[model samples]
Target: MSTLEIKDLYASVETKEGRKQILKGANLTVRSGETHAIMGPNGSGKSTLAYTLAGHPKYFVDSGEALLDGEDLLKMTADERAKAGLFLAMQYPVEVPGVSMTNFLRTAKTEIDGKAPAIRTWTKELQDAMTNLRMDKKFASRSVNEGFSGGEKKRAEVLQLELLKPKFAVMDETDSGLDVDALRIVSDGVNRAKENTGLGIMLITHYTRILKYIKPDIVHVFAGGQFVKTGGPELADELEENGYDEYLPEGSKESALA
Candidate 1:
């Protein structure tokens, strides 16, 4: 079991104005065996929080600390952070032209585990996880995310989640482009991961349909760079029904969190 703590986090992206703040004094905490959901409208800095926690070079943390199991994550590089058991499933997965799925997984496994497992043993586990995610076996030979469908791409992300067994995972809009069937499969995959591994998850999404499939212990409403409300799963249903209007003033969404 592990814990991820983000305290008074202030972050921004490099821009002509020097740094454009995206996350402003945000605070969150997640412990093992719990699933937390963050829901907000567009440009709410949800993805920025994910990238910042994962230590992406493009996103800068101007203030605050991100701790993984009591270790200072801000002091580590991206690969070091991953090795420390932090994983982020990107909203838009990148395609590597020449990286085979099988080989990439093996390399990442080697790096994280500090040694290589027997080929048969590791490959068997990989195949099993892929099967659980309902992915085709042929993808093992294909380049990573190369021309795959949206559902296929999301499944590939979940495959890594299972294979890596990270202490905590930050999923940024993972259900964005998926259709209904794909959404069910993806959410089911998340449920399986939570049940089977006792992993802690922070799911960042804009839709409530997924909350039905993966019931989160806590639901947070993020807007204008910070969280304004935190509630149980019922808040998700309310948001879905009211469409964030009750939470907003006339002709104004910019002040929703301010």
Candidate 2:
């Protein structure tokens, strides 16, 4: 079974001063067919962890291990990690000015699968996914994310999820900058993608709005650059009721950063 195991991950960004550690000894294990939520404040290393796990070159894993189905992800290049079935949906999805969505998807599919999908079948699959995502078929011919609204960009990320169908994915703040309708549509897309692919999802967000739609099997609270508390769905409610202040001392949090 495809799974992700992150053990005591300590990561930092390279700087002139020294390694500015962001994630501190965070541990998480996600098995196949499960959804996990990671919630935290700004600069709490939520996105940092996701980027690092996806093998982003900017951040360095000072100490710890991130394994994908028993393969050492820390040792792989960015493309190697993607080919190994790891995916990341960023908070700020980029826009390509010229590449059509169809072209990009075809290239990614060919690379990931190492074989060309039959044109007839691939087109049908793409259209079907677009329809399910409430997207216009015209988008298939447009440049990737060039003029997409926040909602459209988020939806495009979900579209890739449906098409690529990676074994594991880490969605960084996917719920950010979305309206209620957009949130519901994107959440529905995620649910459908999971059902269709059985992809293990690690959803990162600060708000519980998305959780209302897709119930997570586990909810983890990240603070001070590490996961501080974990619980069921009710924990999200508790955090919503009372913020991270109650979970961490003001002084300890401030000192931890210094």
Clash count for each candidate, listed in order shown = 0, 0
In Å, residue 222's CA in model 2 sits off its true spot by 0.8
Q: Evaluate model 1: give its TM-score.
A: 0.94
Global fold similarity of model 2 (TM-score): 0.94
Give the residue spans of candidate 2 off by over 4 A. 15-18, 252-258
Prediction 2 global C-alpha lDDT: 0.90
Stretches off by above 4 angstroms in model 1 are: 245-251, 254-258
**Model 1: per-residue Cα lDDT over 67-162, one tens digit each:** 998999999999999999889999999999899999999999999999997899998999998888889999999999999988899999999988
Q: What overall lDDT goes with each candidate model?
A: 0.88, 0.90
lDDT of 2 at 247: 58
Give the candidate number with the greatest TM-score.
2
